[model samples]
Target: MAAVKLSGKSILALLLMYVVLIFVLQMWVGPRDRWAGYSVLTPLVAAALLPFRRTLLVGAFTLLAITGSYGFGVTGLSVGARFVVIMATALSFGISLIVCRVRLEREERVKRLMVARDRLSLLSAASSRVGGTLDVTSTARELAEVAALRFADSVTVDLFEPVLRGEDPQDLPADGCVTLRRAAHVTAVAATGRETTALRANSAGAGQNREVHVPARWLDPGRPAATRVLEGGEIGASGLPMPLPSAGTGAEGWVTAIAVPLTAGKATLGLAVFARGPGRAPFDADDLMLAEEIAMRAGVCVDNARRYTRERETSLTLQQSLLPDRPPEQQAADVATRYIPAGSQAGVGGDWFDVIPLSGARVALVVGDVVGHGVQASATMGRLRSAVRTLADIDLPPDELLTHLDDIVVKLSAESLGDHGTTPRGDIGATCLYAVYDPVSRDCTLASAGHPVPALRTPDGVCEFVDLPPGPPLGLGGLPFESVTLSLPEDSLIALYSDGLVESRHRDIDAGFKELKQVLAQHAGALEATCDNTLKVLVDDPPQDDVAVLLACTRALDASQVAVWEFARDPAVVSQAREAVSRQLSRWGLEGAVLTTELVVSELVTNAIRYGSGPVQLRLIRQKTLICEVSDGCNTAPHLRRARTYDEGGRGLFIIANVTERWGTRQSRRGKTIWTEQALAP
Candidate 1:
């Protein structure tokens, strides 16, 4: 009966025609027969076809026909039989009305069951579709498609800006005005008298559903039901859906619309508005309920996506901050670097790099990677980076710096230990490569802690990894780090990178190394360009993990810019050292600096000679700044202290500190060297 369906008016028309046919039959048969009683069939037919109200109308017409049979002067029956027939006809009409009421009630139940089954199917579809992804815009598109397929003709999804950024949204404002971004606008296609879900951004074209960012505008709470729903946190529906400001293509000719707020807990995320077109029936209460459910389901998904995006952004920011802003200004190398985080969905990893200026015109290039993702890994990277810098400040070698860093990592893991201590705390482990490049000797000293070997591109455009003694990864205590020192020619490019650049799921580590070499082999002119092009070739749009690269072009000081002299352990060499320094300054055309250089040479040479050591040595280097260094075999290092006014001997070291821009002492295998740097005029 449901398959061959009819509206109330159609059923009423059929009943009315049945009544007319019964009247025709009464007229055709003579009054001699009780054929007028055949009109009773009309009421029975009406019971199956029409509602109680229209059934009563049909029965009334049948009653008129039965009684009007008397107009034909019925002499075929006596008055008692006529009255009995009239009574039976009246009784039959009353019974038909009761039957009509019961039948209508049962049909109403069946319709409600069908409606419930469809709603369940729709909600199930929504749960499987909209709830699968933790992406805000994708969820919005799925909701729009599911809602518009059968229940609505057009659907619009709008969300708060912060929620789109993956943060919890603020409560609706007191004035009910809130900023919203149009996340999706989907319209259904009506074809072949059937509706199915195919997402359409506009009737002009169709494409993948992406986040829609139009000019930012406030939703008007007083009108245009989208905002009204957000204000009241309820569904807004009317005979004709309100016109949306940004409604597109298939949204026209809509006769029905409903706006529902997407709310989770006490916070309202945004709004969803659904519409129906001219050909479709106007929305009923059941549709309004279903729209609410869809909006509610979408709210939960958007909230989840919002939280995820917020955490990822925070982690990336922290990770970048923990890393370098730009390589510091240093003369040891011309530096350029690049850092790219994993894609939006994949969490941020702990990949970091730093360039630290070491003593004696040297630069330490450090790159490291931790095992995990998120804030913890980034924080650990920061801690290790800071530890490396602190050790470098004390003039530790590359191997010793990594050695201390390993101890720090071990301590960190030990501190995070749980009651069952088999697993190190946070599952912390890291791989690091530390390299120190000296412009004076043109030698790059490198050490590794289970890290990938760095690549070196020669000035002649040859690329190869500078292999070293690969040590155990940090956190496995008691492993000694080994240092490798190799000669780097001038203008050679040294690349320090995290394992992310050379580790892929589709290929082995060797393949990634081959690609890295290929990229570095064909050099771009600028270090910045080379770094960028390297990433473009090796990195995905959103890389699977964090990638960090640090590149430096080597520079060597010319022999003409440096002077070294060795003298016996005698106070007489101090004056000779001052004369030699004056001549060297004159040769370098730095004649103006001769007097101050003489004073610095005299003070430092005198200290090295009288400090009770073996032979004394003096070395002067000219780069961005003029460096004066004096060394000896004395195990004792000098201290700059306040000398008494009457004391002349102790003032030698103090005067050197006052005359130079900066001064410090570093211990070498030969002894200790007290070095001073004075600024040279630009």
Candidate 2:
């Protein structure tokens, strides 16, 4: 059976009853009787139920009562019986004292065990709470909260500046001073029902509001106690002399504080302080040990969080640098673009877009997506963008350009596999859409490699996706890509985007496309405003995938700015072509370029007639630059070469190249068109 505890009042009542019973017994029998000494039971009950001091008082009272009974001559007896009673009474009193001592020892031992159990529970809770996040500030705040609730009236967490920034912890300050930044501070309500303000101090020369400089004397390594705590990773206690005088009114009851070094491995991250108020009990050795355990657990978590933050910042910086600051301005199109990275957990991704200016007043609108996230994906995106720009410089057709890109991706994948015996992640697969828009023809030729089709919005606000062929994604060799050309009306809007804009876990590709078209149709304004609205409507907050959107509005050259002519494969038509070019230049007010234009036209027409097929044609365009074009049913590309002294034919193109800003040939559906651009007169 469990022991029943008696209160002090109950013990006193029981002792009084025993005294009266002893008197009654002496009156009934005699004070010299053998049972008379049984009065000792009064003090023994007191020892079991009352405190030590109260038990001794009860014993003395019982002894005096016995003496009074005997002195009153309540029982007539010889000196021998009296001596026996007195001896028994003294022995009983000695036994009661022993019982009181044993009871006090057991109570003390039980109290210590309870305190230890409570501390262990608090530490367990702290561990579970502090390490849940990989954010340094969050971890520090959690530690402060746990300590303030369980360990002390107030708690403050301060970390070394470098440690907070994820850098290696430096040695203590050279001048024997330490700089620490306060990460979190929490104080309990005072007895007067008011909140206490925490102390704040800025580090000398640091200028940061949250940081403070601790003097060398306070943390002197030479002191045995300081060394034991700083070097040995133990917890130490100190008195704070009201660091905040103004706030001291509310914290008037605060007195002592315990400091625990937040050490992880061999490096000390910072310190955690737990303070007690006047009404609250001062921390004992056991409390200091508990604080140390909590700080140790928090230190490791804070370090991990800081490292993660640093890496995330680095990856984001690298990705942003790789993206274009702004799309290049071109006469072919007005461009606007938007790029948004995925959520933090998803890290940086490989989605990218660019507006590349090509020869012949054409612009290549590109959008691409690598398969994965992080630095590797971003690096791959950069490499692919560079490759695209290189290939675009050669003026390859859209389909052929993607073919070269596919080969590059395939080689990269193979090399990665060769190095590791397995394909490297984030380096292999990607999807891309390439589109070229020419303002002179108001035509856009586009091709895709496992990429989403682009949306086109006519000037009248009608939006629809272009039905271009989809080829296999890059790195998957052997698949051929096809290009489709569509003539856009002047001021028509063309949208190129990565799949992240149209596809997510909750939304399907078709629904995203529908929403995209709806948003574009509703907004009828400048391309920049349209781009902003598209992003606002289609992209969710912290998008699940990297998003890239490129919007361009086509501007076509007017018919008055263009002239075309057809000629037979006859030598005499060269003169007619020259006269036609001169008349066009005269009508267009390009009198300064007339002489150069006529010579260039005569040379190009004669070459076409002699070396090219019949039914040849010539076209002139007046735009940002003066363009001269000659076309025929010829598939062969023209090459420039130096002529020996005997070669009169080679100098024709050489002279044209020198007179024009740039010259190139583009393959058309029927044949090829060799063209040159000259700077227009100011």
Question: Which number leads on TM-score?
Answer: 2
Q: How accurate is candidate 1 locally (lDDT)?
A: 0.77
Q: What's the C-alpha lDDT at position 81 in model 2?
A: 68
Q: Per-residue lDDT of 308-395 in model 2, one digit per residue for the tens?
A: 6676667677878988998886788888999998875577789999999876678899999998887778888999999999999878
- Clashes per model (N, Cα, C within 3 A): 1, 1
Residue 240, model 1: Cα distance from true site in angstroms: 12
TM-score of every model versus the real structure: 0.77, 0.77
RMSD for all candidates, in order, please.
6.5, 6.3
List candidate 1 segments past 4 Å from native.
1-114, 131-139, 165-168, 191-200, 203-252, 414-427, 505-508, 643-650
Error of 2 at 645 (Å): 5.5
Residue 589 in candidate 2, Cα distance off native in Å: 2.4
